[model samples]
Target: MPRWFNTAGPCRADHHYMLPALRRLPEVLPLIGQESYFVLHAPRQVGKTTALRALAEELTASGRYAALHVSCEEGEAAGDDFAEAQRAILSRIRRSAEIYLPAELHPPPFPPSPDISLLGTALAAWARVCPRPLVLFFDEIDALRGQSLLNVLRQLRSGYSDRPTAFPASVVLCGLRDVRDYKVTTDSRGHLGTSSPFNIKVESLTLRNFTRDEVEELYQQHTHDTGQVFLPEAIDRAFYWTQGQPWLVNALARQMVEKLVPDRGQALTAAHVDAAKEILLRRQDTHLDSLAERLREPRVRRILEPLLAGLALGEVPADDLRFVQDLGLVRLAPAGGLEVANPLYREVIPRVLANTAFASLPPQSITWLRADGRLDTERLMEAFLAFWRQHGQPLLGTAPYHEIAPHLVLMAFLHRVANGGGTLEREYAIGTGRMDLCLRHGPDTLALELKVWRDGEKDPLEDGLVQLDGYLAGLGLDSGWLVIFDRRTGQPPIAERTRAVAATTSTGRRVTVVRA
Candidate 1:
């Protein structure tokens, strides 16, 4: 295969991609007959459409099922016009079938208009005429809006019973969100939020990112085809940076192969992957741009602020959760908790928000302590308290990322200190209450947890002490400092709130205080 550098799916010249989802077809194929309506949702560009398309093609080739891939995105603009939307769907089905299927598998007639009743009629006609079972893979099902969405689902539900010989045996709805997250309504008078056309879904299936082993295998495929081996650290960097997001994984590799090392003669190392990450982030490519774009939404801000402070969101509405998850900003873990969906996302968010922070820091001025090395908690806190005494009020109120502003600024300071020599790893997502930042400077590690307290709380002193103790205890460290930002406090003089290092907690552990 030749080298591929353009945007889009696997190109003909370079088709070395071996997606694990495709390899698991044997497992997924049998489930289709048993499950009437299945859903496959994930963050954008994770190969949800590609995987289903491949499945549909394989099923059609088996001579047992006549599979068709139809996109609902084009018709979604119809809003509440169910009939027009249905016609659009049918037209897409006709076109897709013609393109993918052999010329002998003649296309069906797509009527000019299809109401709920006519949709069933048209589907039944196809099922009755076709020799094999009908399977419809509805791509971008979530794109359908208002009643157009409701009409399609209800039509599918109505025709579901007429299976095997009369209608599609199985239907797969693939999009950025699960079927359960779909909000459909038909109020031509106005718009609808949650009140109109509530939840109506059977179950949902989420497409997962490539696992660590799968990531390694995917990288090896590139090496096998191109002979540009990825060093162990490079593999680790790729997995850590992308968390195996399909497009990111491929794109990162492509950047390293074509842009970073066009000759393809040099071995790609972890540093190379790191360099590629810097380039991608600096350029702010479409993938990263789209992810960052949603941050402006109030819903996104509401959920993300608490998260950046290292707090857990108590209870969130299903819609908001689905919205964030769909954006690929976060994901629900197998352990039933929420986390940033992948590392690429985790790294990109802060970078986009604070571009000058890391770049301006002088790498040579900072020093990292080893594992046995100790940090002057009291001194650091004292310095910050002094700094806060002067600039705290003005900066806090003026911060762009208002909710998590303090945390972001604090991180900026530490990032400046640890610039060239240390690592800053963070875990904060929309809906996750607090942000947990782990800063490793050579051997010594500082775990700083941030929280935004509500009004009437002059001192979250009690709560802050308790949480910091727990965080320190988790790391089996008897010492660490906790910085609390009283968002409720009016901008007061920094001198009035200067730094104090007091041994506060039941353990008599020293906790440095920087009141900003």
Candidate 2:
């Protein structure tokens, strides 16, 4: 049977076209040799479990250690009941060992005890009886929280010195966060603290997404199995869109092959990749949906709100920025600062946030279309001005992030305009102080830049025009719009303040300046 792309669970070599799992994790074996306890973390679906499981199998096969991968996810339901969580975790480990380890390496039965502190004693006994030095990978360790989470970490720390004989020689705690970020309550009274309970960790390692070459190599595995091929442009576009995110890379290929084009004789192209991307964005599959759920989190919002508004992140904690990066939602920009992790995420964030406002917008006709079905920029601008006059105030309240309220309202209106067989794209970055929009319909392309004029700041028209000029140059256009939203106190009503005027940029680009 031919192997295919995998989007769910751990990738099996016999059934999935996967990169060499162990090869991707180069630090695990060396750490184990040093008898080091460490943390392995990454965003969800980035293949942490698959790599750890494969490493455990390889280690066991080498006849030097009894290695096992056990999940603490089941214990999550036990909540703060450390005793119940301990039982569930031990049961999970027993089941996993029976399936993955040789009979002699299987841990002996746990002592029947209701005391929560006995977890360390049970593990110490297992290590003493096991035929070889034991190695344990605790997958999804962060799934435990509160007292349950604290108890587990404390138990492990209590057994730290007993390793190599009375306890596992090396233990790997695998989860979505580094140990320092783990939130635990100190007492039953519910006082919270951000301290590492598992302070014995030698290092914290993160699993990185595949590189462009790795993505190409993964796709070539499918070409080797079947006669189908992904064109070079398609591969490049896929990498650019996803930045080699593991699940996204696989999902795009799976979508193209299984849903878009199934015939082996049909070669995949960049257009197919684009269509697949649209489908995924519209469908909001489990992975993207999970990411969207993070938007509601306070820490996530602290960094993302200003990001979408194109403002400098003000006084955000360094750990907060690092947390978002670890979650794979953003990355350090090459120029400086942080940005949405990839083009795909950059597209998904605003669309997801604007979805509710888009639904609330009244039905709009395609009156801005010319006789030849091309989009008319002037007519579209007039229509948007009218829309802003009528509904922008009410719609702005629906946005979850107040810093980007105007931006979201405008995006909602544009979404409605582009609903009729047109495409809209957006670009913003930290400290840009503007949001750039591109609308493509048939042969017409409209470039729009949005800026907010606050009370303390001077007029934004000059800077907006200059920025829009550079943006237009990049798009090979000679003209565009610089929209200045007057948000200063004591300003006239939006209807009274809104109007458009013709202006020229310093770079000699003709710009229609819209003050609204």
**TM-score of each model, in listed order:** 0.75, 0.96
Model 1, 1-516: lDDT tens digits are: 454433475323235566544663344566676745666677777776677777777788988778877788888878888888877887787788789976655446743443666577788778877877788888888788877887777777777778867777777777776665564653222223331132333445666677778878877777877787888889888998888787788778878888888665689998788778766765778878878877766656656655555556756666676678777887776787667777767767775555443343233322333245555444445555555565555555544467676666666666654554556666665443456666765666777666566576456667767877787887777766666666665755556755555556777766665555
> Which parts of model 1 are misplaced by more than 4 Å?
3-7, 10-16, 24-27, 111-118, 185-203, 296-302, 322-327, 332-337, 352-402, 409-484, 490-514
lDDT (CA) per prediction: 0.67, 0.87
Q: Backbone collision count in every prediction?
A: 13, 0
lDDT of 2 by residue, 224-315 (tens): 88889999999999999999999999999999999999998999999899888878888989999999998977778999998988898999
Q: Which ten residues in a row have the lowest lDDT in candidate 1?
A: 187-196
Relative to the true structure, candidate 1 has a C-alpha RMSD (angstroms) of 6.1
